[model samples]
Target: MPRMNDVGGQDGFGPVIEELDEPPFHADWEAHVMAMNRALIGQGVYNLDEFRDAVERTMSHESSYYENWFRAIQTLLKERGVV
Candidate 1:
């Protein structure tokens, strides 16, 4: 079965908007989340595949992009007993 995050080729979600000149992040917390994800990956806390799996496991349709990443990190850390 497809995961919740797997919406590719589906319908009713509307088209994706391309924001020209979009900032690297919309908020400070998103940057922090990115940094944390990088640190965790660099430290061998989780591999890229594991991180993606965690994200898919915790996927929510209402969440924004970085929000999903943040949630996935939380789930991974907790599952690994690192937090």
Candidate 2:
């Protein structure tokens, strides 16, 4: 019953990695992350470098974007029809 937004996906990016070490189930995860970062930056929420840094610091414990992580991803995917 683990959520997709748990670890950092297989590549330590989206969702947590557990059970096994698998490749990114969806490549769009990266696109979603990038898109979300761009949208947020344009909104003055966070800059490009800031967003990148946040992603780079992602540990197996906490997401740099926090709960907002999943929300942003979900929103973008829904809009892109990639969910």
Candidate 3:
């Protein structure tokens, strides 16, 4: 079965679009969320593939990338009883 993160060779996804001149971030918290994911990985909490799976499982398409990353790290840490 295709994992939730698997988007290759699939149809029905809408056209990709980019917002011109979008700000680096919509909010400051987003940067923190991203950093947290990296920090946890660097601390040997989890590897990148695991992190990706967690994010895929925890988030829907509606959630922003950073939002998914934040949720994924939380889910992984909680599952490991670290938080």
Candidate 4:
């Protein structure tokens, strides 16, 4: 089954708005989360597939992109006894 984050063909979610000249991040914490994800992956704490799986598993329809990522990181770390 498709996960909540998999909103490919399903509708009712509305259109995705493209922000002109959008910044890479909306908040410092979002950037930190991205950096942490990179660091953890670089250290071989978990591979990309593992991280993606965690993200998909923990994601909700209401979460923003970075919020989902942050939750995924936490979930993965906790499952691996790293947190």
Candidate 5:
């Protein structure tokens, strides 16, 4: 079964626009969210695949990518009783 994030070749999806000069992050909190993901992965708390799966299963399709990352980490931490 296709997960929420697997939109490849799917119809009704809008075009994906690439930003030529997009900033590293649109918000300060986004940077923190990315860092937290990296740190947890490095510490073996969760692998990249696990994070992606959690985000895809847990977050809404309309949620931003960074928001998904934040939600995935929060879910992992709660599962581990770290937060």
Candidate 6:
């Protein structure tokens, strides 16, 4: 086996790094993404440069965060009837 490049994996995020791209969104999911983005901001997850740095960090690592993050997001969405 060999070492893989840092930004080369399923969650590596590739060139599609920015969180929002337009086409796949339905109106609600668009709102959902924006709301999530806001919540992240409100929570002080990062300042401008730091957010990108944090995302870049995650982009290079293998992420199991989706398992937990999605469940939490979906649970909220379901409770909110956005699911």
The predictions' CA RMSDs to the true structure, in order, are: 1.1, 11.0, 1.6, 1.0, 1.5, 9.7
User: Please, what are the lDDT tens digits per residue for candidate 1 over residues 6-72?
Assistant: 8878999977789999999999999999999999999999999999999998989899999999999
Task: Show model 5 residue runs off by greater than 4 Å.
Answer: none
Query: Model 6 lDDT vs. the true structure?
Result: 0.47
Model 5: per-residue Cα lDDT over 51-72, one tens digit each: 8888988888788889888988
lDDT per residue as tens, model 6, 1-58? 3223243444635564566664655456555655675685577653445444344433
Candidate 2 lDDT at 38 equals: 73
Q: Write the per-residue lDDT of candidate 2 for residues 1-83, one digit (tens) a residue.
A: 54443444356356544756655534666557656667867986655565444444332344444344545544544555756
Each candidate structure's TM-score, on Cα atoms with residue i matched to residue i, is 0.91, 0.33, 0.83, 0.92, 0.85, 0.31
When summed lDDT is taken over every stretch of 10 residues in candidate 6, the lowest stretch is: 1-10
Indicate which candidate wins on TM-score.
4
Poorest 10 consecutive residues by lDDT, candidate 1: 7-16
**Residue pair clashes in candidate 5:** none
Alpha-carbon local distance difference test for all models: 0.94, 0.52, 0.86, 0.93, 0.89, 0.47
lDDT of 6 at 35: 69
Q: What is the lDDT of candidate 3?
A: 0.86
Model 5: ten consecutive residues of lowest lDDT: 7-16
Model 1 CA lDDT for position 16:
75
Scored against the true structure, residue 15 in model 2 reaches a CA lDDT of 52
Sort the predicted structures by lDDT, highest score first. Answer: 1, 4, 5, 3, 2, 6
Model 5 / residue 78 / CA error / Å: 1.1
Task: Give stretches of model 4 more than 4 Å off.
Answer: none
Error of 3 at 23 (Å): 2.4
Residue lDDT tens for model 3, 1-83: 76667889989889999999998889999988878788888999998999988987888778888888888888999999998
**Model 6 Cα shift for residue 45 (angstroms):** 4.3
